[model samples]
Target chain A: MTALINLVYLISVSLFIVGLQRLSSPKTASSGNLIAGLGMGLGVLIALFAPMESGDDNYLIIIGALVLGSGIGLVVAVKVLMTKMPEMVSLFNGLGGACALLISIAELLNFHDSGTFGLAPYLTTLLALLIGSIAFTGSLVAYGKLSGNIKDSWKLPMANMINIILLLTLIAASIYQLQALDTMDLVYFIMILSLVYGITFVLNVGGADMPVIISILNALTGVSAALAGIIYDNMIMLMGGILVGSSGAILTILMCQAMNRSLLNVLAGGFGGGVSSAVQVGDQTVKEVNIMDASIILRYSTNVVFVPGYGMAVAQAQKICKELEDMLEELEVNVRYAIHPVAGRMPGHMNVLLAEADVDYSKLLDLEDANKFLNDTDLTIVVGANDVVNPSALDDPGSPIYGMPILEILKGKHVIVLKRGMSSGYSGIENPLFFHEKTSMLFGDAKKSLNSLLDELKTIV
Target chain B: MHLIIEILTDHLTILFALIMAIFLGFELISKVPTVLHTPLMSGSNAISGVVIIGAIILVRSSGSEDYISLFLGILAILLGTINVVGGHAVTNRMLQMFRKK
Candidate 1:
């Protein structure tokens, strides 16, 4: 490598590190991403400039691929809705996995003709191939689930067991190939099994129960890329892969902590998917509140808190929620948003939704801070949210989500819940908080309900 | 045999570096607040596209590549490029929403 190329690589690595550091804070996150992107662009530019064994036609092909890829990326980033961001992320991640998988395949073919292969690169090739195929196929499955193309319940019985068997088969094939003299059959078999295993593995995970990080199969892509980098001795891939691998792991641990679930349970295709063992029967009636009464309560309150959940996402009520917050703030009311760690389908889903509506980040409070303010608040608005604020999570020992930390919206002096009906949450756990005397149900779609409340507030104040 | 030994040491070096990177990665993004979580996830997803480096190395090293290998190399390059460009662009778009005004 030329000195100039080496210096650029070093600069790119620095940019990645610095950008990642900035991403830890919302204030600098935009600039951080730009910096990292600049680094990646520099790397791509150098790759084009560097000499390759291919003829002039190959250069045309490379540039063509880059342009085609960038066009697709640009369209996806610029045009896709924020609500579908997770699905887009998973699809792109799948492509990255495909990159690694193809690299390993290319290298494996190279080895077949060379008649010589080192142990280290050989092992790296196998590892990359295994993990890469899994990441690609698994990410596609995840994208399907997120996009509702595949039903959540579409899973073979004992699919997890089948996955383990396939995994063992892959390992045994690789081991057998090592003992046997040069043969490409085992490697090809391993690749097929890995791709098949990926599908079967994620198939069993019901969408609602899928863990935030592991569900999308992000870390696996990074793992495969890092291994592939080792095989080829590529520093850019090495650094980027390890960074993603660790970052994804960290997020997984954090999401698990927030959900109060064991990492093992998450990896075992998630728990509490179909039926709940802790169903409760209650005869208490739920009080219904109209927009007029709800707005009156809100207008009079000194402090109000908002607890949003998946229902908000489903109804697309984030914009109205922001409007309501602004209206309340204008009425000299102290308004804040209380966010449960697992409030939405994924980690930080609600935050992203609200941010899209240009809600101030500072007004967003995590579960701990929200708990402190809820007790003193005069009214707490629960919008399209259920389990996250369900006192059942805190008090009902027999509830499936009993031990999970919730928003504690029940602690407020008065609570208004906007819901389509008195249905159970994603975990199939019924909430007793709906029937509490302090809580009043606002039965409707979240967006319409919030619009009504916003209109009523304007009229009253 | 000497060349093989050198290669083994290089792999070992990469292995050690990977181990340390994992720890450092954990430490850096440990306490990221809920609001920044999606952006961070998107950022890391873009970083995963670094496999393009491996793709380039494979494509460049092959002296007399056949049609299948070349096709696969092009496919890898395409996918890697998509990942880097789309991932980072989407992340920046999302982050632009949250950067405090």
Candidate 2:
């Protein structure tokens, strides 16, 4: 029995490694998932069959739990939309943390003698309990913020200061509990306080900061798992936990860099709803053309660049955009799709949408790669995109998104913007690119505008 | 020589597990150039054979008291298999869509 259990553990670990590796790339990610699922199966098999000393004949209890948890997981995995993935990920991480906390608490309660518990077990148990509790509540808050159940902006002022005070209190309580070895009640009280504090701290943070927070919370859950493994003296759990912890930390840091925000600022709840209202339009002489005229210019241009944004997704114009590109290509005009990192609500949102439309992978260039070509291009068609092409980022210091790298689409010989109306993006900043001399606003749905452009192109051909 | 083999055998289980992890990890992260994400995601869904084998091995070897474990393992294996098959079918459909003239 022990041998089989050990074997299963070994197999599960291997699957987990493969799963993580596959996740790095779009191509093999599915394969990696399958391998990971295999590993999880192995782990569950070992955990269930491997004889525990617990004399409770609670086989029915365990079976019931397995059924309930698996059923819930199955429903979530099958029914959840891709748009809600980040929130789902946060919820999943919370479940992991909650499971870790429950198991650790059970272990602590079952401890017959406090004297038998060494420094290693005690320290690990305490750390796991603290981190798991934080992750569980933090993730729930993130889910709420992302799903719009909670307000997207700052709910309370001086929230940071309050969080700091609560943290200090939790720390002092933990220290006292550690010192006062006899008071189990004190430890329990400290744990409960810290759990509430964790939830409130996350609740105060806005949705804009969730990407980084989610990654950090995931890492915390991993740490909890590792601590749980230490408590159980399980090598498989230890390795798996470490892998998740390290990788999650790396991912969190990367996300922070992508947004050009410091990890410290993200943790301190620096992001909120109210955007800076300082408009800096210093008489940079501009001209605006309507949709029909913009199409005429695009038809005659030798080279054209299509820039897509979050608005494209809202309009579901990916297919029409592709058709326009095809039409442009037919006209013997060079065409390419310029994508910005933060173009959509979530990372890879642009990529997924474009992929769905079967856009040529080679033609799709990142912000840095595409920025150089935009200046020389005869026509830069800004389709349902705003903030990414906003020139304010480059010129105006007072702009909220100042110094953030953006595709300089305004520099192109001719620019046409496909937008329904003058609406602010997620950052709630005005795009001066709309008023630029070389730019034109084609006011309508992106799909309808692009379809019209395609028709115009066909007639010209 | 005997000692070396004994040491290898003792840790062989762990070694094999790590190797599988390494392979899967490598395979997972190799992003299908953004263009391939849809097909790849769908394709990977069908690779449930590994889970099935693991579950079968576990249940067959598990003792009487391990009934709960066996049941859970079997259930996991079934779900994993379904995910793999369904994922691949979706990938195929997605790819076929692109091929439409």
- Local distance difference test, each candidate: 0.81, 0.62
Task: Give fnat (model 2).
Answer: 0.05
Query: How displaced is residue A29 in candidate 1, in Å?
Result: 1.3
TM-score of each candidate? 0.94, 0.75
Per-residue lDDT for A1-461 in model 1, tens only?
Answer: 78888798879877887888888887778888888888777776776676655544356667788889899889888999999877788889899999999999888887877879877687778889989999999888888887778887676887777878998898899878766737788888899999998888877765554446443478888889888878866666787788888878888877777777776666576655554545455677899998888889999999999888878888999999999998988889999999887777667888999989988988899989999988899998888777677677676676666687888887789999988987777656678878889989999888999999999988888
Local lDDT at A67 for model 2: 61
Model 2 quality (TM-score):
0.75
Once fitted onto the true fold, the runs of candidate 2 whose alpha carbons sit more than 4 angstroms away are A1-4, A112-115, A204-206, A271-279, A282-288, A300-304, A314-335, A357-360, A373-376, A381-386, A397-400, A444-461, B1-101
* Top TM-score prediction, candidate number: 1
Per-model TM-score of chain B: 0.84, 0.58
TM-score of chain B for predicted candidate 2: 0.58
lDDT of 2 by residue, A1-461 (tens): 77777777777776766665664554555565556556656665665566656443344544554565556556655665544544655666665666555555544543423356544466567777788788778878877876778776646577778788888888887767655557467667767876887677787654545656766776676667666665666656655655566555655655566566787777766544466646755555445566567778877888788898867876888888888888778777788989875565444556667766878766788776788888778898887777678788888887766776888887679888877877666566777887776777777888888887777667766
